[model samples]
Target: MSKKHKSEHHEEHADESWLIPYADLLTLLLALFIVLFAMSTTDSKKFEEMSKAFNIAFNSGSGVLDNTTIVTTGEQMSKERENNRQPSKEDLTKEQLQAAMKQEQEDLEKLKKQIDNYIKTAGLTTQLETKLNQSQLMITISDNALFPSGSAQIKPEARSLALTIATMLNKYPGYEIVVSGHTDNEPISTAEFESNWDLSSSRAIRFMDILLSSKKLDPKLFSAIGYGEYRPVDSNANALGRSKNRRVEVSIIRKFTDPDKSQNIPATPK
Candidate 1:
């Protein structure tokens, strides 16, 4: 009976030892499954945090999660670099503004050249002049070209010249044209007109009417002004100087004048 009791006690001890190893195996399997789940997830940042927690709990600083944090940091840095490469709105707007200004300058230069060529070809250099200034493109016509002495009426032959000028001007739309008339410092008292102001004003209106007669010309873009004897380009002391002073001007205003250099008038004379 003593031998049987000792055998039972030994059997109990062996069973307890087997149960301890089984519990250890189950714990190892659970840890392995947790590591696999963390690796399969797409969030590298979260995986890195979880790995750090596990390292702290296990009192070990080495794991695969360290590599995951490096990858996450690299991705964030790459995104920042891409954002820096993008252009801002102010930069794009500045480039576009420069391009537009350049295009406008070219167009104005071309138009000025065309007018100059016409003036040279027509043998009207003495009776006509064109100037491109910062404020406007001015085409000056001698009073003898369009009117007689002490008269506001435009000559019959001058109508054809006005028509030709209108045709050329119609090619460039959206520009404001000011037809201004100036007289010499000679007082006029006639049955038709009272003073130089009335004569100059009447001449300007008549010329503008002829220019606006074209079907392609817009009347809204044209205006008439009379400077009378006030704005004289030359002294009215002699006949030659008076002739130069008595003139009609057609001015095409600039669309985009530079604000910084607005007062600087770049004169291209012809």
Candidate 2:
């Protein structure tokens, strides 16, 4: 009877062995839930560490989860901020730039017309000429109109002419005016000027000074240059050619434009 009781006890314990694996499965499920809950609350860096621990415990050196996209909360926030950094296009639209350019063109044309009319009325067309190009509107004046032979000083009779020109220039504000002087190939040496370069430069500066004497014009918008005899419009072989070469040029430059540059300017910062 004692031997029979031992056999029945051993058999009862054999079925109870299944409970060990069941308890292990329940523990694994609980760990999985805890890992998932932690991942939802923490950053990706911490989550990766926890995942490694769980994988080592449950998977026995194998991976329990597959590799996937793992962006941190901080990383996600940074990405969102970057997306919002683009400039707004409302303040500097393309239409606004085009309108501004059009207005500038109209102002330039009006100023040219006024100058042209003045030249015609004064009967100075023979001595003065105007040329318009992509870069500037140039008013060319013969040297004889403003000075005597080898003299850098403006003629006393030309004072009225200078005043008239200054008055006309005063009508246009905020424009860059360049006064450039050119001379004939004939060399000149006198008590005042030693060479053509000196003569031309002095003439340019003298003319510019007169133009800036008007209170309505800004001195900062004017500059003087001298080309001497190097930049001549005609050959120096004859009197007429030499006459055309000795001239003063007043140039009014276009505002903020380049014909070769792209017209589609970016309205806002990139």
User: Candidate 1, which ten residues in sequence have the lowest lDDT sum?
Assistant: 57-66
- List, residue by residue over 1-270, the lDDT tens digit for candidate 1: 999999988877544668755665554454455556667766576567656544543453333343355346446656866776744324457567556555556667778788888889888888888887677888999999999898888999889879988988888887889999999998999999898899889999999999999989889989999889999999999999999999999998876655666554333444
**Prediction-by-prediction clash tally:** 0, 0
Best by lDDT: 1
Best by TM-score: 1
TM-score of 1: 0.62
Model 1 residue 269 CA deviation (Å) reads 18
State how far residue 145 of model 1 sits from its true place (Å).
0.6
Cα displacement (Å) at residue 216, model 1: 1.2
Looking at model 2, the pairs that clash are none
